[model samples]
Target: MTFENTLHFAQQLDRNDPLRSFRDRFLIPQAGGKELIYFCGNSLGLQPKAAREALDRELTVWQHLAVEGWFMRPDQAEDTPWLSIHKRCKDPLAQIVGALPSEVVPMNNLTVNMHLMLTSFYRPAGQRTKILTIGGDFPSDQYALETHIQARGMNPADVLVEIFPREGESAWRGEDICNAIDTHRDTLALVLMSGLHYYTGQVFDMAAIARKALQAGVPVGFDLAHAIGNIPLWLHDWQVDFAFWCSYKYLNSGPGGVSGVFIHQKHHNANLPRLAGWWGYDEDSRFAMTKGFVPMAGADGWQLSTPTVLAMAVHHAALQITAEAGMDALRRKSEQLTAYLEFVLRNSGYPLEIMTPADPAGRGCQLSLLVHQDGKRLFNRLVEQGIIGDWREPDCIRLAPTPLYNTFEEVWHVGQILLKFRT
Candidate 1:
């Protein structure tokens, strides 16, 4: 599997790609009538071409049926009542996240779902009052943990234990993380970590970490925002206590699309504390106008409101695409595509450092570059050239060669553009 930094080579690779046809399923962005090399799927995936049609179908149902859309069966074959449209997403999303269909539910946005899950998992009592998480997590997660602890009358500094990579390293070692869990086993109430770190684009050893935490008598969870569709996961097999992810990124739902949650079957009937709503009540008695709050089983029990039909419509369109392509195939292409990008960058003679781990097992599609100087200028240059990648604060530029839409030729072109910056 030798890679040559030439357009001909890239073109040949694209021609040979089994998943190349997937690129046509998405509507790539254009600037001045030319398609831009879109490598930002880690942030927002390209819209699937089928999204509009799916959305239109939902809109038509609303137009013709009005209020009755909630109950009226559109057809015997389809059976898509608006009241339960969210249920259609469960199987597809379950496939993506490797959970039982009953264990996964497509619901609210990421941060909101995080708060809801925290309510159930982050119960501090006795000496076990601290929440363990990794440093440099997405800011929203940090804020959520801090505020939740404060709301419970605990100081963040006292209850939060954040682990960081040893000095000069960009990613945390698996052993270090496991040892930290052991070190703080006595006071830890919950272990919350990102499945794939947002900033450095490093894939944490989630299974190992989860095992360690569980062994220490702690419940573990993950924020899978960057991990969901971009990587393969076995949440149920991994025995993860809980997890949540947004759909807009590699899942290819539109911006602010619906999020998904996973709660293991072991906890389905535990009667854990939750912030309840009518939508979460047992389905059979939901419309009976009962006074008591009886939650549904599994992840549905965590729902706080009625599903957003339009957003779920968009999500369904995207998850359908993911289901068609399959996660194993997507992951295979991602490794090769990202490895090619790394080869191109290394050979480009730029004084840049790749922050992501070299091992394909330790990352998804993203490659973060630590530019020696003038990082912003270099990022702006790429943008000016219609090479869209993301830039994080100090000196890193993130590019994700999303397997579903991005091609080998585009990865090669990015290298050419990056070399231009070196001059």
Candidate 2:
């Protein structure tokens, strides 16, 4: 679509968007008392208007019942009250991540969940002690891997292997990931990579990588922070060993919201020693005050303590929205919106380059762009104009027109402002 024609096309798209009604649910942020065109969902999603109400319900409980709210289930004087509220969200959370209800658990923040998962999954021994991951992964992941290695009495350099991007490739190909697994099979303990890379916005081939990793006797896992709500995933069908994600990003669960973990059913009873706590104990026997730990079976076995119900309440609201929209339906529109953004940028005479995968199956709504030398200036200018997209250091700027709240016209307008930085 040309610059003159882009607006018309965008308006046409907005009219036809099936998910258009969902946008009204959020309280879009404002700059200078005017609404900003937000395309930064990859970093932090726009707040759903329902979020405040959901959290408010908890506040009301706190005001009235105080600590009694912890044990009062409706129609049952015995049901653990506020404590059981977290369980209410389990099914929807599981459905959103494409896992069995038993395979997913709402728990701590992202890095803490990763550490917990790694404690169980990253048991490198003998010669196969190295963990393989992609370079340019999110910094938290890098730190987690390094610190985990040292904690295991292993040298980070010797036990952590990062495969660099190919010379001309913006993101590593599936073949390269498979090759790395095949070549290092004898010595590699695990393959951990971002489901959608934070810097490049490229969706890695999780199923393909999982298949290869399993075939090579290696367990595979993903950091799904950027992929969970932005794309369709089949973790159970993919036969992934494990995965984890924070709900605050694409799930719109508010900042520092409750995160979760997924453990394949096969591993739930595999006698793996986890960093367990009271919450992981069998619910039936937890209050009985047993001597030894009897895990609650499946993903609940990974929980460490009583859940943050207020945080979980916000996440439940977000997941309910996602469930209503359906992952496939949102993804269908996301592909078109992102592609349209790319199309408009190509027509602008700027030294701009889109680093996100061009293939729809290999990407989400996020598009990470390289702006040669004036990236920071261009990014600041866009922000000043109330066209909000996030900037990463060096030269990359990231934009994500999330399907839940972003309009096609917003996408086009952001593109127009980006085009202005060409000269």
Off by over 4 Å in 2: 1-4, 73-80, 421-423
Give lDDT: candidate 1, residue 86. Answer: 81
RMSD of each candidate relative to the true structure? 1.0, 2.2
For candidate 2, list the clashing residue pairs, or say none.
Answer: 71-81, 72-81
Q: 1-423 in candidate 2: lDDT tens per residue?
A: 333436888998999999999999999999789999999999888888888887887787778778877866434333236767667667887778888988988899999999998999998888999999998799999999999999888898888788888898888888988998999999999999899998899988898999999899898999999998988889999999999999888999989988999999999889997898998889877989868889988898888988888888888888889888999899989998898888777777667888888988888999999988888998899889898888888999999999999988988887687677665
- Give me candidate 2's TM-score against the actual structure: 0.96
Task: Evaluate residue 49 in candidate 2 and report its C-alpha lDDT on the 0 to 100 scale.
Answer: 86
Model 1, span 1-423: residue lDDT tens:
999999999999899899999899999899999999999999998999989988888888889888888888566528478788888899888999999998999999999999999999999999999999999899999999999999999999999999999998998899999999999999999999899999999999999999998899999999999999999999999999999999999999999999989999899989798889999889888999879899888888888788888888889989999988999999999999999999999988888999999999999999999997999998999999999999998999999999999999999998898787777
lDDT for each of the candidates? 0.92, 0.87
Ten-residue region with minimum lDDT total, candidate 1: 71-80
List the pairs of residues colliding in candidate 1.
none
The C-alpha local distance difference test score for the whole of candidate 2 amounts to 0.87
